[model samples]
Target: MKVIRIAAALLIGPDGRTLLVRKRGTQAFMQPGGKIDAGESAAVALVRELNEELGLIVDPTEAQFLGEFSAIAANEPGFEVNCQLYRLDVAQDVMPAAEIEEVVWVDAGGTDELHLAPLTRDSILPLYRSLQSA
Candidate 1:
């Protein structure tokens, strides 16, 4: 199976809702970051993705490293995504830019009706739930 490595951000608001974005023409709503470029740390890639996708400015240092996760790609049948995940406590309002067609800030369990990328539905949501219960 082919794997696409990406750096993703679990951006949480002061209200405890996490930010999820849907790419144009894609049904799955996943975390906000994007592919990691060669020679770039995951944090740096996240910073660039945040700016490009959400029009938000995030310093690389502000990202709290979460860990790595893997799940089947929501949109690609044979590809998997290996994600380097990070969390940031931020409330900056986001607008869809670049390839993003829409945005939603919802609780972990709130997206059941929406198609979620495997990384978000599998690994990331469990981690978020664990944090909430703690």
Candidate 2:
């Protein structure tokens, strides 16, 4: 299987909902991030993606590394994403632009109406909930 190295972020709204986004023509709602580019650090890639995908500017200083998780890619077949995830406690007002089709904020355990990316359904949210319970 192919593996994609991506940098993803968990953005917490003031109301405590976690932000998720769907790309154009895609059904799964995942974190607002994308693949890391060549010669870019994970943090750099995350900052760039957040700007491109959600119109939000993220300072490298505000990112809290949440380690990495891997899961089958949600939008790709025979692929997996190794995600370098971060937690940012601040919520920048996000508008869907570029390739984003929609945005939703869901409780960590609540995804009843949304189709979640594999990294989100199987890895990120579970890890987040576990961290909260710790």
Candidate 3:
């Protein structure tokens, strides 16, 4: 199985909601990110991805490292994904751009209704919830 290495962000708003985005032609909503390019640091990749995918400007130095996680890939049936995830608490406005078709702000604990990527559902959200309760 192939491994997709990515850098993603858990974007939190002033209202305490987190953002999830659905790419065009994809059913499962996931964190806004993309594959880490060769020689690019995770934070830099995440900042670039945020700008390209969500039309949001961010500083790489401000992204709080939330550790790495791995799960079965959401869109690739036989592949896996390893994500370098970060928590970014920002109140900036975001619009879906590039491949993103839809964006949603959801309560961290109230995401049962949406079809989420496996990485988001099985790992990231649980971690986020635990961090919230800490």
- Winner by TM-score: 3
Residue ranges of candidate 3 with Cα displaced over 4 Å: none
Candidate 1 local accuracy as lDDT?
0.91
| Deviation from native of the Cα of residue 62 in model 2, angstroms | 1.4
TM-score of candidate 2 relative to the true fold = 0.93
CA error at residue 19 for candidate 2, angstroms: 0.2
Residue 125 lDDT (model 3): 87
Over 1-134, each residue of candidate 2 has an lDDT whose tens digit, in order, gives 89999999988888777889999998999998999999999999999988888888879788999898999999999999999999887657898988999998888668867788988988888877776667
Candidate 3, position 17, lDDT: 80
lDDT string for model 1 (46-132, tens) is 999999999899888999999999989888899999999999988788978999998998885788788888899889988987887
Candidate rank order under TM-score:
3, 1, 2
Model 2 is weakest, by summed lDDT over 10 consecutive residues, at 125-134
- Give each model a TM-score: 0.96, 0.93, 0.97
lDDT of 2: 0.88
CA lDDT of each candidate? 0.91, 0.88, 0.92
Off by over 4 Å in 1: none
Backbone clashes under 3 angstroms, per model: 0, 0, 0
RMSD versus native structure for model 2: 1.2
Give the per-residue lDDT of model 3 (tens digit) for 43-89: 99999999999888999889999999999998889999999999999
